[model samples]
Target: MSPQLGNERRAADGVHSGESGRFTSPVRSSRLSPLAAPAFRYFFVGQVVNRVGSSMAGVALAFAVLDIDDSASALGWVIAASSVPMVVFMLLGGAIADRLPRAVVLRGCNLVQGVVQTATAVLVITGYAEIWHLVVLQAVAGTVFAVSYPAFLGMVPILLPVEERKAAFLLIGQATSAVGILGPAVSGVLVATAGPGWALAVDAATYLVAAGLLLLVRLPPGDRSNAKPSVIGDFLAGWAFARHLGWVIPAASASLVFNALVSGAINVLGPVIADDTIGSEGWGLARSGQAVGVFVAAFFLAKVTLRAPMRAIMIAFVVWCVPMLVLGTHVNVWVLSASFVVAGAALSLLDLAWNLLVQEKVPEEMLSRIMAIDGFFSFVATPIGQLAVGPLAIAFGAGRVQLGCFALAALVAAFALTRRRITDVRLTGGPPPQLTG
Candidate 1:
């Protein structure tokens, strides 16, 4: 069986243990002190900057694409181009994260993205950009994301004490949600007042800044002394472990279906519905409302100890149905915005819980690989979802397609309960201790 993250903490604490070898004490609860770590602090700042810039880029890109073609189909093709590579290269990226210095990998990816964005800005500014140009450049940027994502995730456990990681994730979520609140609007205004190209230049600058900060942040060069040199071998080993030795891979298998339903429905289709029903401004508010909910939940997660990790995750997931309901029913802006808020909080909580669990349980050497496999399957279906949703919406009414998507999400979350490993995870109760693992 796979060793749980709780067991790793149990081993580190030495104060408690059981036949199953997990920390049965509430002392294993997460703490917020990781925010005090210098390296993590810098990394945290970089993420915040990164989120803000990306948010701005989201608005800029939408305006840029629409300005040229004024068609959502053209926009979908641009998005699908980038997303395809992101899903395709994730597994290879995971192996690279394990084999190389994660910081170096992340730094390089960030720099490449910076260059890509600069190229995007130049193309837009020069008015030479075409749909084909964006598709190609976005493909390159998407591939870089495949590497940097696992690298960033794999590097986080190394940056903080084990006990501090849970809280660190919440803080990161808060930072991201909080910044995301303003990203689309502020960038939209800038795109309207100045131009999309200038806004893109701002995004490129943020990537450069984040990359520069990463240089000052030092981390352990991972242990390679005992490992095979082949990257493919490393990936196979990780797959073997998660498949045979642990439950993570199984959970990810479930999530793969989950993401396909949720990612596409909410991200790709929801906005289209919003445009048709609630209007574009209402859609923006709905997004901000979701951000607000996420920000609030992050603070709550930072403080509360989750005694039943998977139970909490599953319960939070029920809220996901609200979005599906809204889309199916053509709810007013008030209902749509409220649904977004609830769904956003649920999504953020899931992100925090899952990441914290992996960082704590998995050994550092294999964390990236496992993370890659997890993420690879988790998101590999996203491009399919994104690409298919548009056509699906065309074939079926967007409402019916979205309703079907939500049903899948609801069913997936419910399915999580049937997996004993996900539900079997137990966090000890009592006043949460400051530090233990």
Candidate 2:
């Protein structure tokens, strides 16, 4: 998952039954009806703008590094620099989000990120860009993201009623998907014609705009009286709660493995492969195809309820193998792009299922910390994978490395299915399962 996907939170509030925390039936409305609320409308528009820039930035950052030094290791170092700090500070970020006003936290982080990205754009555009310059800027940006992510997730429940939360997520997902389609394709053209620096500039502009829009959103004051004595205490309480949950640890671990192996292969090695075959423009199209798949899935999922969410999640994992296989074999650009569409659909399903389950199951107050733990587990090994994949590709060849990643992802998915705690759990209509000691 990208950092944007990584930053999601859900909880039952306002619309749940007393004490039991079970959801009451939401008043029926059109799926897009959540946009009617002023707060959610502001939040949604900001997200759309932010996602467009972010999607473009992802492609731009990779090519920017390549333009400076066309080696996979160089790209890996830059990517690792960002991932490592996010893993390190994620728990603390979660703790802080729980203690402070989430909107303020997000706004502050966005301002910092805007400055950092702007600096990066200046360096690159001015022809003073170097691997280390990109590395340092990205590292700062990553730290800001670590703080902003939990805040971003925790803001959802505050913005919408419990009944509308699902629709809000689906709407946001759909908007993100729509922009995901547009951003990468446009990014490709910009990178091809103007240069990566211009793309980064666009991303910087969006951050500032998003920050301004956030100012217009008015959220209800969060209850912070129950906060622990210290951030450490808060984090430890969250850890205690999480450790007893049979599925959380295992699910997070699997995410870690998938991201380490599969994500690294796609982000790092896939670009290298694309450069040799389809070129950067074609690479952007492939990403856009993936976005198209996500858009389609979000549109359908909004209309139907998932019966076996975990089963669907595991199936999504298995589907990821196809894209890896396609990339490993250096398929034609059309075939490669087609494979990504399937993979993207699977990703959308898995994310929706996972987010809804957590939103319904976890306590509202503990949401940020729990999400932080999930983020930490899901991302801890990403740096290792990013740093190692380049050397592995150099040693084993990119195709073989991609195949290995596919096998590992498949194995992880299969193992996750064997755990009864994961497979037996359902989206219940009553109080969340009590966390046992």
Candidate 3:
């Protein structure tokens, strides 16, 4: 062939090859990179709406149950029922996230939560809301939430650029904290006047709004190799990763035990404590104080980047224990409110550090699975903690129980912090290396 003809043939071949490659490649467009795109705004907004609504619903639910059951033991069972599903399905949820469209999963989860909330509202309004009914509904909600939580948590990296991922998480956390501030306050009024039904209806409405926002946003396709793996293998892979990672295992372990003890105490006994020790008004005040503390910490966190993540984590945990100790001391309602405020501040800071570390250290495809693992471990003992707290308080007495929990948590946190394995983590200046070949 002539030289011109030969060049034309080569150009045609190149075009065909490029077209073929486009059709075969698994990766989708990264147009929504959190740093560079406007879509992240929608994602962030949706998160704010969803979080605020959920927070309100949480307040309403706890108070509603307390109104009916009244006993800490009954309350413990109700709280435990809510968290059990999360522990059971988190890893599978992670695998599902890795294999599916995150936006679709999130939207579906929100819809399910909306339905659950609506049902709860109906139950309460009709006077059909038995304690057992609440437990069952809470379990369903927890299961749906298990799917949504990992998918949403994993979506951040997919939605944002590696460089700005920290900013994305900070934005999300700060927005949630801001909602936490207002949600409980508003929920208290709604619960006081119209009953828990009204607050739940609001929560259902918020979920609808969140769903609409998410539908407007788009996400890139995720890794789907798990489609071929057996269920057990997939779960084991997630388990193995969590168990093996230096940062993940310890961090998750700490979170698991800490949240179990803290959330269990707060969720089960907080309302009772409020009613007896501080009054109903004081419950909202304490919640608002904590939310404000979180908001303030988030504000500073968004502005300042950390070089020493492990140290930040350690300090935050120590900060967390102080409030527990203070609460145990029975320093009056004002002092307890102050303690919760400080505790909330410390938790917000701790969460920011933890999120950054997780995002930086974990692979993107496995992020959901890792998150699932984290959620499972962090929450698995929560019910146990919740269940145990009531009886333990009865057995050892409330004051000693509180003190013992505080001391154990503090000692564990301190030991974990001092370990060379945990304290050595630094803020990765950029995203950890992409796992893609």
Per-residue lDDT of candidate 1, residues 1-437 (tens digit) = 22233322222223344654333333444444555556777788888888878977866776677677765566777877887888788887888887787778888988999999999999998999998899899999999988898888876666655555677788888888899887766775677678788889989999999999888777545446545568887777777766754567667777787777766777667656765676445655666767777888887777666666777767676675567788787668778778878888887887877776666556766777878888888888877787788788888888898778777777787888888988887654322222112
Give the Å shift of residue 167 in candidate 3: 2.0
Cα error of candidate 2 at position 27, Å: 4.7
lDDT of 1: 0.73
Q: What is the lDDT of candidate 2?
A: 0.80
Candidate 1 residues lying further than 4 Å off, grouped into runs, are 1-32, 192-195, 277-280, 427-437
Pairs clashing within candidate 1: 5-361
Kindly list the per-residue Cα lDDT of model 3 for residues 133-251, writing each as its tens digit.
Answer: 98998899889878898888877655554455666676676668888887887887778788888888888889989999988766434435434357556667667766667677777
Please write out the lDDT profile of model 2 over residues 269-296, one tens digit for every residue.
8888888888889999888888888888
**Range of the 10 consecutive residues with the lowest summed lDDT in candidate 3:** 1-10
Ranking by TM-score: 2, 3, 1
* Candidate 2, number of clashes: 0
Q: Positional deviation of 99 in candidate 3, in angstroms? A: 1.3
Full-model lDDT for every candidate: 0.73, 0.80, 0.71
Poorest stretch of ten by lDDT in candidate 2: 1-10
Backbone collisions counted per model: 1, 0, 2
